[model samples]
Target: MDQPPVPPAPTEQGEPVALSPPLLHAMLEASHCGLVLLDDMARVIYWNPWVVRTSGVALEEARGRRLGEIFPESAGGRLHQAVEESLITGLPAILSPRLNPHPLPLRAYAPDGRGERLFTLMMIKALPVEGGARRTMIQILDISNSVARERQLREQARELRAQAEAIGRLADHDNLTGLANRRLLSELFFKARSRAKRSGRPLAALYLDLDHFKPINDLFGHRIGDLMLVEMAERMKACLRGSDCVARIGGDEFVVLLESLHHEEDAVIGAQKLREAVGAVCRIEGKTLQVGVSIGVALYPRDGEELEMLLRQADAAMYRVKQSGKNGVALTTREEGGWPPFG
Candidate 1:
């Protein structure tokens, strides 16, 4: 058994009175927190039952041993420095878990009940006393549970943020083809128009309607129609520039936005490329399939300023192509790129 610490306390008359060592020993033995007493040389003089249970070192073994000898990992840490400062200056110091976590090799069961080895989070305090051979006392509090809860909350917050981003993407994208929906296309149109105004460049919208699509959809099932639509969207995407955006507005109808255009002729070339991509042969569900597209190109400041007006003019031009023949492209402006009034 180790001896009790008799620290001095001042009476009302300013006289130093020593606390009862036996009673102090009993109290320290029942304490929930770890309590250690060190002599003038910073060697352990008293090791309470709490310290014995937590550190797994018997009182007789801890007696007359330096803290560094008991836990070599704490030799150069803040806990060691605090003990030295308290013994020398008779002042108190605290090592918070935030700055000096796991200064001592204290073990505890993981909060998640996994039976894994977990380093106990500790808040250590070194205080100087005034009596007996014990000059300093070290107190350690277990804060592992609180730290674990804080980490769990941060992890939950990150998961919630990721879920929110995924939801936002779902809202803006078409469910079947994974292309921009009409709502997102409308929103992006305004932003692209803003860029066109700032850069003094032309913007174009290509309204495309697949020719003879309903006959195929009627012959095959809707599943095949859906798969064919996905294939066509992918081919259109592959042919367009990175800055351009393609959207499936509805069944057999799509729209392409040409955002960066140095010349209006780029819109014509892009429309031709899209017609070729849509008109290619594809094998869907082990059956050979082919399709044609009538694309109507509309340019900014020539067709109309608003997206709705541009799409309307492009739709009219596409109707003209359907009347003439399928698998062809048309422009809202005259054939010579001359300005035409909006009807």
Candidate 2:
């Protein structure tokens, strides 16, 4: 019968403890990460059970084989370069996931329970041994879970940004006509007014009210009325230049802002074009419908300096058009006097 193995002698306090070869081998076998040891000749000498499990290679078969023979795919890769550097210069090397994502072909079961093989995200370390024999120890840590979490966080950030943009659009635009809402219009007015003040150029604000619109709503239901409103908004936008803005401030009440005008007559021309475009016949839902507009023009610094003052004067002028028959345009004249009847 064989005798029991002797235990390692205990060291003094704060000193290193000696472990027997069998205990060291046992610890290595139970390690959680991969460990591969190569001799000076670059031949596989020892490897932990973790390496065996991940690489799917038996210990007996890989004991004396070269790394190139064991993992052919890693022969011309970063791992091979790192191993060569460590063996020649006796310097340590680290291969991070960012630089070398899949340096090795080590496999693991996917987390989805499908028993599919997934190439692991590994952080590899090659350390040169400073012992009696020249050797290199390679350590591999699986970082698949961490990498997956980082990817998920990036995707979530993009999704959140998209949602925020959608919410911003909803807040700044009218839902029915997709025109600039009050909030956006106020901001636009501020910018336009500032530019007009600096350049001494005139800015025109045309306040428009659709005539015969209420009759359509009363005769037909609100559905057809809504379609008409949308159609009218499109027509008004088409009649203006890209630099101009048209906003539906209220039901049947729209405001057009024309910037960088060459002359005061430009406002009248724009107003007439809008009047014609809006007064055109619309066949919405097979119903022949026609409407007219009463437009009131207000000039910057001439009518009023502020946006509210200009809008108010323009609205007042529009009301004057409404009182005098209908389907006509009126320009807010100087404080001393006003323009005659015009369309």
Candidate 3:
């Protein structure tokens, strides 16, 4: 290896000495980053030692070659376009890693012993020279670590959003049956009531209680009772419309909301369907367990304008059904003179 030439030492009188061409070339080669100089025609005029080492291209072979011939992948890419723009406008243009990551194929050894290496890229600009010819200079940088960090951050953000959604669902839904809990049901009731008031449609709230529930819990364990409640919730859901809502208020008690009813009779029909669905015989653990449901119905605007009032009236009627018979449905007659005729 030949040593690069150095500037002559100043005379004893302290006179300035112009640096020689060899010394200047040595200085450029000693740069830490990859450097390349291209003529107006985009042919490589000079390349630093860093470029040769990182790109694995020899200085003699890279000289006077076009960048496209050296790196074909960058021929029609943003890096090439940036060079053209700089040459034409006599200004520099930066290629962001976000839009154009890994524009160059040049690679550097990883710090770890692993064989993996990160790719490098460059920022390009036009450099004005003598004789009215413009040159393009490319300053290379390594961005592998930055890209990896950004990807990690995006993945973490996605996981956090998913966890937040799961928490929200847990807060608003019954854990055992996945039905709307009392809090969620209250919110839905208010929304349904607003829609009914605007469209002149009737909404029905049915308060349901499982009859003979204590005997089943005492005969079998609470586990069996819980399974029965879960099955009952599914059956109730099957009997309701898509717009309807079913909620487990507490142990052995559930609420069903029927919205957009054209007639008050529709509510009675819905309550009967629910009663039949719950009253059906369910066989669990090789033992046939027969249970019944007593439901009280309250119509919107007719029974009461508020959710609390309507719920109270429905509860009162449901108790009346339980008093008369375990498996039956009843309509509230608080506001009306007496009980309406049941079809």
Name the top TM-score candidate. Answer: 2
Q: Top model by lDDT, which number?
A: 3
Candidate 2, 235-341: lDDT as tens digits: 99998888789888898899999998989888999999999999988899889999999999998867767778888889888888999988989998554224333
Query: Per-prediction TM-score, please?
Result: 0.80, 0.82, 0.81
Q: Which ten residues in a row have the lowest lDDT in candidate 3?
A: 109-118
lDDT string for model 1 (128-153, tens) is: 34554437777777777877898899
The lDDT of model 3 is 0.85
Poorly placed runs, candidate 1 (over 4 Å): 1-19, 39-42, 72-101, 109-121, 124-126, 129-136, 333-343
Q: After superposition, how far is residue 59 of candidate 1 from its true place, in Å?
A: 1.8
List clashing residue pairs in candidate 1.
none
Better of 2 and 3 by TM-score: 2
| C-alpha lDDT values of all predictions | 0.82, 0.82, 0.85
TM-score of 3: 0.81
Order candidates by TM-score, high to low. 2, 3, 1
